[model samples]
Target: MPVDAPMPGSYGVRIPPWLAAEQATLPARITDRTERMRMVNRIAARNVEEGTGGPFAALVLDSDTGDVVSAGVNLVLSANVASAHAEVVALSLAQTRVGDWNLGTDPARPRALVGNAQPCVMCLGTLIWSGVKALDFSVPGFEVERITGFDEGPVPADWREQLEKRGIAVDTGLLQEECSTVLEDFRSRVAAGTITLYNGG
Candidate 1:
């Protein structure tokens, strides 16, 4: 059991390596952004099938080496920890595995992160310091509220500009509607009372 951080009080959340190993091998060895996003959707779809609720999922990887550093899915329902968003889980494992927060210029791996949705407020906040190199995501933050009825809170209107300003290459709309379908699935199931949200409510 590894906590995401060594800070006091909250002690962060548990990061089991088994989960990391299971998701480490991404769907393929392709470098195209859209293909990468479709792979992320696969992880998300599995979450739905396994009854993990709104299992938003993410993968942390190294661009230069094309290695899946780690992968994460929402664990709030299973772990009873509200901090277990997919981006955070993936980012946390990534930071630990790389042994440093800043990894872009590293002599090896040259890390990055990819996710199925625009980062929620908390995950967006974590990225500036997570220090992978590039940020790639599938959906727009606005659609998160519109299509899924999930209120993504307080994302600074200029958040992307801010990340770019920090030298973090941020790419959005990777798979566009394809990625949205996963959210739509969750939304439909939630409406039917077949799926529940640990945090999305």
Candidate 2:
């Protein structure tokens, strides 16, 4: 390899046109936690049908007002990027929208990240660094691995404490049955050779 081999300078993932249109139809604010989780679950299920990526979707929301800041689905397969998980995409979009990398900068208007499933190891680090004040998820990592065969990596046993120590609130098992149903459906599709199962080392 040479220094001037005309290497690619940059790369990025864009939300699919369909997902963007769906986002446009979302209400300006969703105050109910159950409703938030329901939306994420629906998006995650649709991601599999859309053949975008794995069964996952996430959102960045104003914790206080429940205003949706950004929505993202797994684009790892479609975007050809391993790091394009739902949580990362949503967080990145939120950062870009606010023009600040640190989401917790505004103390009065804290943010929360809501996802269909628990974050993988890489996304755990992303969440820590993103400065979001809270995390809400529907399904656990074990369920994700059991149903989808996707490796979530070795998340720390004290993962909740890790986030709490940094002043990030943690909530889990929101609409677990619904979220797990989505994962189960994705597994069936994969078994039927209709969808690709992506698992990174």
Candidate 3:
């Protein structure tokens, strides 16, 4: 006989209190791409400092008006869920706010997902299925693995081209230095035994 299904609230992710407070105080619109990325980097660094999760954060924004649709940080360690990566949380939150799963259904008003670092293989799949039109990120997956000692999985060699082929604009190297700094700090903390590096078996 098949086992009973798990309870509805047994597993779920949540935006940590610090991140929620910051999200509430964001401006109505950002307008500048650099500024948008800067915010993401800051959030990533703060996530490490707060010991909520890994040094990663993401935002879903209205590509046209620069309105922040939703913000999310990696909640894997905090929520005890493996799939709580920043990209997944951000995209899921965006879908919830708009009352639809397809974020790019309207071509005119597309949404963009911005992150402090490149998505791992799992998150890459989530980004494609989430219907976001554009992806902007800083720090390459290889560099992230090198700095933080987390397995990013086998991201495709031509991941950018694949996204482009699917009509998703890929913008890399946004605030690279600043983003790398956050990852480096996380590494330092992990070395000091102050942060837990959660990697799959």
Pick by lDDT: which candidate is best?
2
Best by TM-score: 2
Per-residue lDDT of model 3, residues 1-201, tens digit only: 976976576667888899989998988788899999999999988899899999999999988899999999998999989999999999999999999999999999999999999999999999999999999999999899888899999889999999999999988898999999999999999899998899720
lDDT at position 195, candidate 3: 86
- Candidates' lDDT values, in order? 0.74, 0.92, 0.91
TM-score per candidate, chains pooled: 0.83, 0.96, 0.94
lDDT (C-alpha) at residue 18 in model 3: 95
Q: How displaced is residue 106 in candidate 1, in Å? A: 1.8
Residue 171, candidate 1: C-alpha displacement in angstroms: 1.1
lDDT of 2 by residue, 1-201 (tens): 559657789999999988999899988898999999999988988898899889999999999999999999999999989999999999999999999999999899999999999999999999999999999998999888888889999899999999999999999998999899999998999899998888741
Clashes of each: 0, 0, 0
lDDT tens string, model 1, 1-201? 988966757556654454545555554355666777887888877777666546478888777666677778877766677778888888887777778766565646556789888888888878777777788888887887787787677889999899889877888887777788888888888789887754551
Model 2 C-alpha lDDT versus the unseen true structure:
0.92
Rate residue 158 of model 2 by lDDT: 97
Task: List clashing residue pairs in candidate 2.
Answer: none
